[model samples]
Target: MSAGEFYYDQKVLENHLISLVPFNQDLHVSKLIHEVNTHDLLKYIPFPPFESEEEFIKNFWEPVLNAPGECLYAIIDKATAKESGESNAFAGTMALTSTSKENAVTEIGILIFPAFQRTHVATNAAGLLLQYTLDPPSAGGLGLRRVEWKCHSENAASRRAALRMGFEFEGIARWHRICPVGVSVEALEKRNGTKGEQRGRHTAIFSITWDEWDEKRPKIVALMERKY
Candidate 1:
């Protein structure tokens, strides 16, 4: 199989709690811009907080849109409805990138808004993504052999979430990449005469192989399917 074969006709994955659908720029971009501007949710992420809608598009959405072999999905809370007086149902975004068809591997990256954190939203969204990635093609899965979860080592919350979702801690990459200073941190430091510091961010890598998923799938399914 080729990369295109795996990504072709990317499907919508959903459960009782959340829905993972292919991100639509027109519909999602504005919502994302509002969320980013209103909250400091993107602080731990590599990119700086988006100051405007265009910056959000050029810096975040456009890259994912143009990246070949990458599938990005908007995380929607199934419980929320526009008629309920909300501007949008979107909660965050998750992605599968660095996919290798011959090797049957891909990496999962996620960003959940502050409003949705600590709920079952992240776990169920992850479970749905995992289900779609590991299940066989005939059964509507990506048929992947390995799925990776990598995060900044300093991100303890992310590490905990990965372990809870059944991804095993593999190892850490030191000085993995350069990341911008978060808005809050930068602001506090600027008040003390320091600013514009980009630092090396260490990354912790975790993974769930096909066999591991086979063992863990039932438990995850039960967890996601249970009343929330």
Candidate 2:
């Protein structure tokens, strides 16, 4: 299924450096596989490292993209596209998940391909989505009241990234989830108290609410507009 009502019908978002397109399996799957052919790059996230497209489709594609109030977008880099001869640069993927139309809320998840991790792709792409999801509908945006960023509490880099994008730290949820062993790479509990196949994940939640958007938006814009 496509995205639920919480997300507007719009399909594409772009800026000078990056473009966010709803992921299409037929068009994007192969490219995604090519970019992240190895499983090591995905060890930090949940699920096993898939070696084949079938595994990826079964473990990732269906579980994520087919869920209610969730939609995935491919982050395309124009600079890479120009260098490679491909139509667009396939940098990584991000998603709008846990959406609620009634509450006007959504959560974002992002995964940057290994090659594109330390550069401008992540910031610029994140800025574009934040802009689209929080801006008023009259401004051709979603008018969402809240945009959340949730990640493993042990993943300090993730928390920092969210803060960099204007998401304020809300606090941690202890034993927030039961993750399969090896899946919770950032789980400090793995080496501490947790045992057996199931490990507990401490989740860190962050958010940018509508009330704070006016003040935060400009700061994010300035970060995005800076020359790399």
Candidate 3:
């Protein structure tokens, strides 16, 4: 169930499932564009034989930062790590796919940096994302109605994360598509590149509706407060 490993022959579509995110970097609702981009963390997520950090950042970084339907964010430790002045860093990026021009339903996506994986950080970030996305914009939120967490069937870690954050499991889309595994040069493209005969695996979908989110907020907020 570890996100770090998978058992499928075709690379799970998780590779394509990057975390798109949003956050209140500043107090103003109009300042949402200021949210951080953590795509640089993807370099560390993949296995080694990894190229220099700079190269990895250059190639794979911007797609997450500048993605058409996604937003990204970084979680810094406030205090720097001992080895360098670099802030103790983790990724807490989420993607919100708008259901309409007014953006009523926003499907979410997320990923955590390897160093910060398997901890409260992931859950906290998810809670924040949910809170910001589903709350009314009048309350400085997005007023969204639905949020989704879709993962490759083989990415048990991601599935677990969604469940832990209280998202409801929907169904799966078999043969979703293919992408690279970790940083491997090998790509798992679909058979004939058609929806037909595609060799990809299922995308496990999890979702939370606005009402359930509203009902759950008091408990989630209390849990998050305890973690801080």
Per-residue alpha-carbon lDDT of candidate 3 for residues 77-183, written as tens digits (9 for 90 to 100): 32223344332332344444433435466666665555556655666666766777777868656677788877777677778877877888888876554423332
Give the best candidate by lDDT.
2
TM-score to true structure, per model: 0.84, 0.86, 0.61
- lDDT of the candidates, in the order given: 0.76, 0.78, 0.50
Q: Against the true structure, whose TM-score is highest?
A: 2
| Tens digit per residue, CA lDDT, model 2, 1-228 | 333333467468988888898887777777677666554544444444455678778877777666668888889888898788444578888888878888999988888888788799999989999999999889878999999998888777888999899898999987776654344634554567554545557789999999989899899999988888
Mind sharing the TM-score for model 3? 0.61
What local lDDT does model 3 show for residue 80? 28
For model 1, residues 80-135, the per-residue Cα lDDT tens digits are: 74345334668898888877777889988898888788777888999988998898
